[model samples]
Target: MIRKWAMRAVIAYFLFGTAMYVYLFFIADTAIPQMYKGTSADPATFLNARELMLSEEYSNIRNLLFFLNKPYQWLFYYLILLFGISAAFERWAKKTSKWFSLQTLIYLFWLSLASFIVTFPFAYTSYLFSKTYQISTQVFSSWMRDQLIDFWVGYATMAVVVLVIYMMMRKYKKRWWLAVWVLSIPFSIFMMFIQPVVIDPLYNDFYPLQNKQLETKILSLADEADIPAEHVYEVDMSTKTNALNAYVTGVGSNSRIVLWDTTLERLDDEEVLFIMAHEMGHYVEKHIYKGIAGYILLTFAGLWITAKLMDLWVNKRGKIWKVEGTANISSLPAFLLITSVLLFAASPLTNWVSRYQETRADQYALEMTEDPAAGVRTFQDLTRAGLSQVNPPYLVKIFRYGHPTMLERINMAEEFKQQVSEE
Candidate 1:
């Protein structure tokens, strides 16, 4: 009893201490100045940062929405942890005479549904805020449908993961984490390969970009970058979002360059080319493949850590929480919570790797297009369209910003111009 209490106290201490550090040190006010200190360049004409600055009202609203959304998200997750939802669900699931997989599936379905229900108001409020701010064009009905689609996707994915997890646990008994980590490799790749074709289309319509002139320029860039594609696609995101985005998706035959309609419609041709070039650079450099390799290593480490930590946690609290074992359906939430905490703690390291890849892609865009000014302008356009913070604190950059900040991107473009000039 004493040991159990002691372990719980330690965990509680670690969890809260880490949370406070991450929030205050990583997520608190941290945006550096737009132009680097000691740099005497007018980055607007030189680097394109000045035009993207939002009005005070828009900046505050965007920042406010972001700040509000984070806590709302954490509240739901915390409620699940504070309440004995996982153990209770497990006990209830055991009462059912269904197959173990069926029981797990049912429990997961309810969990997903309940999570969506609890979070919907907060989610809708976010959408309302976006709409009010002219950032989201999605109608309530379309948004609800997207939410429903999201639930299905999440439910299906969870069910599959849970089934595989317990199956491995039952079979291996002890080395299940190793097995699951191995399984995550192919599953992650498969997910990426299918997302563009199978999953993404459910949320938005995609058509080949219709501007023949721009299409030719993009294909020319792709050719120069040696990216093979059927064609670039334009997703009708403007139907639902005033925010702009574009990306390279999938791998191999499934690979595609998908531009949000908002992106195509909002930016000038040079800016659009820069955006496409950046995304295309992902393929030219094969970041996805490299990311998968990195992900495999990360997963292996994370799962090992999780298994060790969860073993200690459950050893002390299993009886109290009423979770029978790691194999129990009720333990899923605990597993999720543990992983969530671990992932949060690991955010800075992971975010840094992502930012590095993004920066590389940015560099590639500058080189491939030979258009540093346009590349800088592209980010400026994105900042206005997406309401992205121009210069988030370095700590926020370490934890939350997967891509380089607008300021950093502009700085990169400035540096690129100097490099080209020396040539």
Candidate 2:
């Protein structure tokens, strides 16, 4: 009777969470659009507005790429339901004369390998689309090499995660979730600190900014904002893609600003300065630290929720699924499937948190630079260079976008101009 009640509670928990998320998504989708949808700062007001005009061929290609991935997302779920990568890996690992940890290592290795193989078609299709649109300039050999590197990186990361999970399971079976959540904080920070120095360099070359004049200007801007001003890095992205981007990465001593060569080549000095100021704004606002804090909180919450859901699910379906426990290894795909479902259902809410931070960063950038016109021009450059949809459909914005739409950002710049004029 108690188990039955627990099951009912889990179901209720999921349903209530889903309903709440849907309601919030609806609210954001409806309310936020009216603020900027047809405003004067709408990208339509700017020439080369990506959303306003496109050749039919380009439009068809863009729309096809946009919608093609929706169904492909289910490939992960379907593979779990059908071929069962986790089950196969677990069963195969157990066939060896290995200890439990060894079995887990082997299981993880195979799972990662299987994941890469299973998803390569989707990756290839996406790559093809990027190539078609002149976004990706990478040669096939280079792309394949990157793919292999990515596989190993994923395998290493997951190995640590799975090993820690099982270690906690063995050490503190009753409340291992709490322990895992605690450990994740430091691990996440360590990743953030090392990512710029360690992980990113594995794929791209990064050199100190060669443009002495622009570097001086950027350092001046950073100094004004009380940020670290040395060591601006330029990534050799033109060798890989035509997309323009700049970002602040790492934390503390490892923090660095990296700009793509394409961005430097494509945008003029004023526009580039506006973009750099935006990146600086992220640091000045302590967004990196805030992001870590958010991750820490989400870590505990996600692990706790997963623990309950996994326990309930395994209890109900363990025998049928040929899985003994949460740490059984065969149960991994089920865990992944459940967590993916939870995340997918909750994406709008999560994305809203990211959008809020991005919007804050935009406002801060405007204030720090005091160049509303330049800010507006930066977005215009962004649209043409990145081919970003000016106003993505509401559903896409709610679920997929981590930043506010182009129109929303341009509107922010316009509002800044108005406020400054009034002052």
Candidate 3:
């Protein structure tokens, strides 16, 4: 009976995803708003006919993948539980280790390996699509190496998270969710603090901005913004892709303004400064700290809800699933399945907050640089370099867009230009 239900759910999910993709790709109106039809903000104003077509195709494909990935992940976990694979993993782990933590690690390694294998196709397909679109410059061997690194890093991180959660469960019992939530606050911050110095360098080399003259200008901008930034670092991204990006990352002493080498290579000094100012905006506005706070609050609520759901599910179906209770090591997939659904459901809220912050940064950049022309041109160049859609489908904008759409950004810059002219 459970197998039959799983099959039906999978079919329904696939069909619904297919229908949504078809509608968005073929039927949705992805054109720039009528208000900008002949204005400079029109995508056609910057992108040629071929570029526009490619951007739409690329964006649609990306959206399709984004929509499908989460549900597929949920399905994977569901199948693992239904087939008793997770329970079997538990048995194997117990046989291998008398210690609970060691047994947990053994079980997790097998589970993580299976997940890695299952998800590799999605990652490869994304790479293939990017390669086809001339967006990826990476060779197959380099890409595979990166994939291996990602898998191990992911497994290690998951190991820590699962160990902590399971340890809390063993000690706190029904109150484990509260304990895990408390610990997660510092864990999240530590990850952010170390990510710039520890995790990031494993994939690419980072060095102080080689262009001293450009770095001086950026530092001057940072000073004006009251940001305590001392150095700007550039990463070697040219070997991987043609995409251009810049960002603010880390917290406190680890805080950094990082520019992709592609951004420096492709953009002029004034444009790069505007981008720097935008990143500085993030620091000055304290978006990172605020983001952490928001995450902590959301997780507090989510974990509480998850505990309730886990209890309800385990009490009702734990026997048939070959699970003893919520505290069982075999219940990790079930826990993940619940959290994944909650995360997906919460995406719109998170994305909206992110977009709001991005918009403020754009505004801050314009005000600080007082170079609206450079801002507009920089955005246009970004769209061209990345093959991004100026205006994406509404649902895509809600679920996937952390930054404002290209059309909105260009319009903001143009408005800034107009306001300065009046002044």
Candidate 4:
């Protein structure tokens, strides 16, 4: 009976994945219109930029990525396939007390293996570009080694936390929904604090921002913007890649501005200042707090709905499954399935919020900086440096991009320039 159920589980995973791929392939173009339909400074130019990206000349590189897209997608599907297989096997083993602990280990091994395989390629591609362009110092091999180490550490840490949550849910089987809420909220906080202090350093070297003059300027800018900044630090971003970036992280006293070393190397003083202004804008506008608050609220709503949905699902599965909770962590396959579906549905909502915050930051940066031209130059250089598509389909831009496209940024800056001239 267990063997029969295991086969059914494996086949179901393949079918679900296939269905998802089919749905995306067929409806992706229809699902979202690309450019910001919402009122902005100018819709005509925005539409032009969107149209340009879809043009063959502008999108050649993006089109080429499609060559690898399928293979990458298949790799993901197969990783999930492996995960489902192991999960089914684990469930069978769970039937007997003697095999329970051993099966749990086996389940963890496969879970780690699947996650590693899925994340490795993304990490590799990002690493390769950074190193090749001198954006990062780490070679391909070294990056791979580091990734492998990081993978196990991360996988072990997350798995242990999840296992504890699962145990709680199981213990309170009658109140599994309540258990999920209680565990997920604290778990989210645990994750946030751990990511910066522990996980981040494993990937990149974090040190005090080395350029004293630059640091002072940044702090002053933040003060001017009425954003409190605790520390200004630099990450050894060049070690892994050369892509230039600056971001503000943490909140209140813990909040700091981290400038990528590569950003300093590539940008001139004014350009760096403009970049710093942009990051500080996020703080000044309270975008971080708003985002976190929004996430917490949404998460609670989503979690409640998910718990209820899973409760119905668990009940449907009936006496055949002796799991304690509506959402069993040991039934990792089902957990993955449900989460993937929820994330897929939530993708558009997530993208919209991110784009809104980004645009707000961009506007704030313009308001804070004395040099709009510097912002313009920085955005232009960043676009050229990254080989990013200047024009992209409105649908693609809307769905995939977090930041506004290069063309859009330039257009917006030009508008700002016009406003200054009129004044």
Name the lDDT of candidate 4.
0.63
**What does candidate 4's lDDT look like per residue over 1-423, in tens digits?**
655655665576566556544444453342113553332322333345543333333233333343344334444533343335544555654554354345555566666676667656656665554454444567767777787878678667756655664566667755655666666666766666566677777777889878888888888887887766656888986765646788877655556678888889989988998888888777767887787777777766776676666677656652355444443544554455565557656756787888778877888778778577887778766764554555455555655677877667766877888798889
- Give the Å shift of residue 238 in candidate 4: 1.7
lDDT of 3 by residue, 302-344 (tens): 9999999998987888887899988889999999999999998
102-205, model 1: which lDDT tens digit per residue? 78877887778777887777688778777876778888899989989998998898889989988887888789999999888889999989999999999988
Q: Which candidate ranks first by lDDT, i.e. highest?
A: 3
Clashing pairs in 1: 30-393, 31-392, 31-393
lDDT of each: 0.76, 0.76, 0.92, 0.63
Per residue, candidate 2 scores C-alpha lDDT tens digits across 383-413 of: 6666666666566677778899877898889
lDDT score of model 2?
0.76
Cα-based RMSD of the predictions, in order? 4.4, 6.0, 0.9, 6.3
Segments in model 1 whose C-alpha atoms lie over 4 Å from true places = 1-83
- In angstroms, the error of model 1 at 83 is 4.4
Q: Lowest-scoring 10 consecutive residues by lDDT in candidate 2?
A: 23-32
Candidate 3 structure lDDT: 0.92
Best-to-worst order by lDDT is 3, 2, 1, 4
At residue 196, what lDDT does model 3 achieve? 97
